[model samples]
Target chain A: MGIQEQYRSEAAALLSSGEVKLVIGFGEGSTADRRRPLFARTPEEAQKFVLDAACIANLSTYLVTEGLLSDGKKVAVFLKPDGIRSVNILISEAQLKPDQVVILGYAIDKAEITALEGRNISDFSLGEEIRSHTPPPHILQEAERIEEMNPAERFEFWKAHFSKCIKCYACRQVCPMCYCRRCIVDVNQPQWVSTSSHTLGNFEWNIVRAFHLAGRCAACGACDRACPVNIPLRLVNYRMGKEVIDAFDYCAGENSSQKPVLASFKQDDPETFIL
Target chain B: MSEPFEPKIVAFVCTYCTYAGADLAGTSRLKYAPNVRIVRLPCTGRISPMFILKALQKGADTVLVSGCHPGDCHFTAGNYHARRRWTVFRALLAFTGIPEERIRFSWVSAAEGAKFAEMINEITEQTRKLGPFTQYQELQKVIETQSTY
Candidate 1:
């Protein structure tokens, strides 16, 4: 049997035996090249699970749905390394309990699908690998290209891209870390970020979003994919990520037990920028 | 001749240290640049990154964030935490193409009144040299002229 069949049987068994209350995987999407999240509550539903290279969405996001784990039953979800990293982050942030999630992990490389060696979060050694794994060359190259520009050119560069933002906030919607009950943009007390027609406010919205994710981004590329305007969201994320690593030697979601870089601080952490 | 441009500078200071430092500067009768308008907060940790951006949006030509030294935070670790935040936030600002020169950070204790006074004068002079910040404003005008609004 193929790997897909193997995972399907595994999912079916998990559901049938009541080992897990739900199996979240991919079903056939609208296009053959696409995959949609499939939630299997019963053994028959588990058979429809599609484990393939196209299953890219970080399914851990669904696990954060309000009250899903309130009753304390286990839910199994198929996850790539990035999705697993998201789980680690959520667990670290106290958003989800580690015992409540059972991750069925996979990886896709160059259109090839392969199973990652893990079930429980602790079963995998992802910290070292994620820290050492260099991001793709294009993101680095683009970041460098932007850095080479003068301040004026750089400002113009971002202004052109951000103005295209319709403020639809699909980027915020797709992110797992963005599980705020009330997002800052939605708060109107001071209304620092206006809700409408202020283009500068739109820029501020994107900047604030990127700022909030500085040391916390799971690097799942969800925001970049979700963006309708193709604003190089990853480029900004990569730059901020690089800053935390360079300044504090910190990597997000690298370890489940690791302290969040911003939340905790060392007295000796670099402050050269602080005059 | 037309009046010279006086760049608007907003300084966000921790009341425990920098604000006290500013108070000392005044009490000492030491003169500093009058260009700065200071907003006092409880601690440096209270200086949100949004405060800086909002200052810029509200027509400040530049912003200065000052707090206690690393170990001297009135809350014991507030400045240390604030230091880390500014490190990340300042980089994010630069990456988004905000001129790094436009945002400044410093350490000021209650004893550093002269330092505070001199630093404000220096910032005021430097901002005067840099002239008005029109980058965000120009973009604001871009959105303002659009018929979509």
Candidate 2:
């Protein structure tokens, strides 16, 4: 049987056996190639579950939606390796319960969706190999290209991109890691970040967004895909991710047991820049 | 005639150490550049990178973050944590193309009056040579004209 057929059958069995209250996966969009998230609660509803390259939305983000866990019911989510990393981050950050999520992992390369052989986040990996593997060359190339520029050119490049920001915050909405209840930008006591979408505010907002995800981005490309302006957010995020790996020997979502790179530091962490 | 550029500096200092250090500098009759405006916080741990960015956004040409030396934090380990944070933040600022000299991080204990004065003088000289931060100033000018209230 094809992988799609297999996924449908497995989702059906999970729903029929009451193993999970919900099976979150992709269903048809308005067109044949389009897909949207489907939450299947019944065995028949599981038939709508789709698996393909076009089903690229990181389904794990939905797992943390505000009301989904209110009933304390179990959920099964279709996840790629990057999505799995987000689940690991959520679990480690005490934002989600492990037992409550049954991950159905998969990976798509060259248009083939192959199911990953794992049911749990730790089943994902024991070290940085899985976390650092397979960063898309396109994103890495752009990040490197930016790094090659002179500081003034780099600033101008980012400023030009930021000036186009309309502040729709679609990037924030789609990121699985941007799960703050009260984002610093929203706090108004002293207004840390201005709310306007003008050049200054936009620069501050985008920089803060990237900084907040420094060591924690899953490199899932969701933010890049979600952006309506095509801001190349993944490149900025990839730059920060590379810095974290190079400096701290850390990768986000490697395992539930690993301390977050920013939260914990070694006494010997590089300090050559400090005076 | 337009006066020579004297860079405005904002120093976020911990009350226990760098603030006292500055006070000691004053008591010792040690004269330093008078361009810096100090905002005293309880510890270096209390200084957020946002405070640094905010100072720059408001037209300050340079920012200084000074506190107790490592293991000398009044609150114990506060400066250590601050050290790690500043390291990462400093890298972030540099990667974003902000000149490294614009953001200064140092340790000045309560007794280091002369050291504090010297550091200020050095920062003032360097920033004055670099002139005003026109990039953020231009952005701020645009923001003022737009006034999205």
Choose the strongest candidate by DockQ. 1
Report the lDDT tens digits of candidate 1 across residue range B93-140. 887889898999999999999999999999999999999888876666
The residue-by-residue lDDT of candidate 2 on B48-124, one tens digit each, is: 88898899889899999999987788988788777767776776777677888899988899999999999999999
What clash pairs does model 1 have?
none
lDDT of 1 by residue, A108-205 (tens): 99889988776898887688877776668998899999989988888888888887788898988889889899988898888778667456877899
Please tell me how candidate 1 rates in CAPRI terms. medium
lDDT of each: 0.88, 0.85
**Model 2 docking category:** medium
**Structural similarity to truth (TM-score) of each candidate:** 0.97, 0.95
lDDT for model 2, please. Answer: 0.85
In Å, residue A186's CA in model 1 sits off its true spot by 0.6
Q: Which regions of candidate 2 deviate over 4 angstroms?
A: B141-149
